[model samples]
Target: MEEFFNELFDYNFFCNKQLIEACSDLKEVPKESMRLFSHILNAHQIWNARINGLESEFGAWDEHPLKTWEEIHYENQRNTFEIITNTDDYETRIDYQNIEGRLFTNTIQDMLFHIINHSTHHRAQILADFRANGLEPVSLDYVFYKR
Candidate 1:
C-alpha cells in the first residue's frame, strides 16, 4: 500500500512540476489558472498538516505568487512523503477540523488519494484556461506521465 501511494505521489509530483514549468514560461498566466493552482497547492498543504496534527499555514483559497509555486509545492510533497513513511496504519482514522471548523474523520489512505485526485481535477481546469488564453496546454494525464 505504501509503495502504491509512493508511486502515485511521484506521478503527482511530476505532473504538477510539468505544469508549473510550462506556466513559468508564459508572460501572463490566466487569473483562473493561477487561482486553481493556488487552491491545489494550498489544499495539499492543508491535508499534510491535518495528517501531521498541525495547523495549516495556508488557507484553501489564498492567492500565492507564481514565483513561489514550485518551492511551496516541493515542501508540500516532501511533507507528504514524510507522512507516508511514518504512518504505520493506512486505515487509522484521522480526526480533523475543516477550514469552517467542521469536525470530520477519514483514513490516512483516503486523504492521500484525495490530494492527488483533487489536483488532477483542477489541473484539467487549468489546461482549459491555457487553451482559452491561446497557450498550449500541458499533457498531464496519468498515463502520459506513466509512459
Candidate 2:
C-alpha cells in the first residue's frame, strides 16, 4: 500500500506540473478552479503537518486562503516528497482535529491515500474548468502517466 501510494503521489506531482505547463497563463484559469486547487493543497499541508506533529504554517481556511498557483505547486511537491520518504509504521495512528473542531484518528497510510484521492477529485474539476474556458486541459490520468 505504501508503494502504491508513493507511485500515485509521483504521478500526481508530475501531472500537476504538466498542467501548469499547459496553461498559457494562470490569469486565464477560472477563479473557482484555482480556489479549489488551492484549498486541496492547503488541506493536504495542514493534515500532513498535524500527522507529523509539526506546527501548521497556515491556519484554517478562514485564516489563510492559498494566494498563488506557485505557492500551491511548491507546497504540493514538498508534501508529496515527504510522504514518499516517510517509512514510519503505516499502522501508527495520527490524531487530529478537523476544520469543524471534530477530533479524528487515522493511520498514516489512510491520510496519504486521502490526499491523493482528494487531489484527483479536484484536478478533474480543474480540467473541466479549462475546457469551459476554451483551453485544452492536460492528460492527467494515471494511465497517461504510465505511458
TM-scores, all candidates, are 0.98, 0.82
- The number of the candidate with the highest TM-score is 1
CA lDDT of every candidate? 0.95, 0.72
Clashing residue pairs for model 2: none
Q: Enumerate residue pairs that collide in model 1.
A: none
lDDT of 2 by residue, 38-122 (tens): 6666777787787777776655442233345556667866776676577567778889888778989998878888887887888
The alpha-carbon lDDT assigned to residue 122 of candidate 2 equals 81
